[model samples]
Target: MTELFDADPQAAIAAYGTEAISDPLDMLSRLTAAAAHTMEAMGKRVNDIEAIRYENKQGGEQIRGEVKLYMQAMAQTGKFLDMLIKSGFEERKIKLDEQTAGMFVTAMQRVCARLELTPEQTVLVGTVVPEVLRGLEA
Candidate 1:
């Protein structure tokens, strides 16, 4: 149990004889253990961040799919409404000749005169008309 340090204040660390230690491997092993522990902690942190990123990606994809489905449903509803209107006109035995078409167009214009719609919305509604006719045929 020789004291590891000497009373001499000026004694360099090299002057401490290494013979007192039975094995230098113990110091190396401790150093390796500390490094391994630090590496393990860092690996776990990276794994957690990756998992969070994966979840976010999946959630974003799911939201996109839901939005697509909602748009399709809206389109389908619009088509159904258009078909109902078309069928009602057909039930009246009204042929869609140029004159009838003009009259109907004018009537619709008068009906929507008070309400304002953007050109895009009007185009969207117009696009659904053919789909509604197809649906009615089916």
Candidate 2:
């Protein structure tokens, strides 16, 4: 492990470029942009899901199926987000992988608890989380 030091660190940092920082500002900017896009997509998906749920909430087989799909999608999205954070930390040599993952998981759990979702919305979120993660990793 490279020991952290203060004196004349520019040479050492230049050796690793931007990746050496705890949180590269440029990387964070890109991640933030991707996250914004994901949030927009998620909003649209939620709207569609709400429409479907409203249209077919008569306690039928389809409703059960949709609910199951929705839950699965949500879980998958959560996992992808975890992957994103993991990759980001790995790339940056951040030491708090566990803490970062926990923060993301906790945030997702809180969001899920607050929002009622449908299958479409869940799937969309799943897709978006991975995309955002990829952006961050890059």
Candidate 3:
């Protein structure tokens, strides 16, 4: 097996060959696999909760009923994703409102001045700040 170096991409490519280059679908497949594994683990947790519920019932103890909350969370997450898809949220180009964007830029400018950032560093921050702020929910 080839020993790959993450820090040195050229060396990693030389060692592992061009097959090391990843495509979107490859990444998506890996993500899907991880999600499936997570779901399986969550299923086991639900089973454990059911066992606890059963034991508490047999012993005439009060059930904590965490499984209901867990199921609700899962259902809510699914509904949220479904709504996002149906609403074409990802298809639209979303951006921060100008007022909020200006406020963020002004704050960052103050931060840059306080930190005494180099002119180039300040410029770099100015360039990326808008995109970064837009990525977050308001």
Candidate 4:
């Protein structure tokens, strides 16, 4: 790729104490990918918990048992997301932009699918944005 020299000087000064954002767009891309990777690593952890659910359940009770565990995780995720949003908005004066909102939609979809949650379990997990859910499911 060509060298990207165009960096917002103001942002660099604020965030990095530099004259310009050294890598600019490349830094954003790297950070985005790193965040995605971290989430993936965290996702694998749910499997370990679900495996315990699987072991403790009778064959026919597999769905019910795992759904319970799944719901607990989902509820915690929702609470954490809510807290993060509040913290960002209140403490940092950061509002959720459309791009971040769309990202949250995708993340909700991915987590739901990863847990293989049912409709009832979905309700227990909360966060039912009609348009976002519909679009994700579609």
> lDDT for each of the candidates?
0.53, 0.62, 0.62, 0.57
1-98: candidate 1 lDDT, tens digit per residue: 23534455345455754467564344444444555555555545544442332225445523233344445555555555455455464444344466
Runs off by more than 4 Å, candidate 2: 1-95
Superposition error at 32 for model 3 (Å)? 20
- Span of 10 residues, lowest total lDDT, candidate 4: 1-10
- What are the per-residue Cα lDDT tens digits for candidate 3 across 36-135? 5555666577777635454454677554455665565566556555555665544532433566767876887789999998889988887787777678
TM-scores, each model vs. reference: 0.25, 0.29, 0.29, 0.26
Encode model 4's per-residue lDDT on 22-122: one tens digit a residue: 84434444554555555555556656563543333454534444455455555655555555555443343234466687798789778988999999988
Error of 2 at 40 (Å): 44
Q: Kindly indicate the candidate among 2 and 4 with the higher lDDT.
A: 2
Please provide the root mean square deviation of candidate 2 (C-alpha atoms, Å). Answer: 25.3
What is the Cα-based lDDT of residue 110 in candidate 2? 73
* Span of ten consecutive residues with least summed lDDT in model 2: 53-62
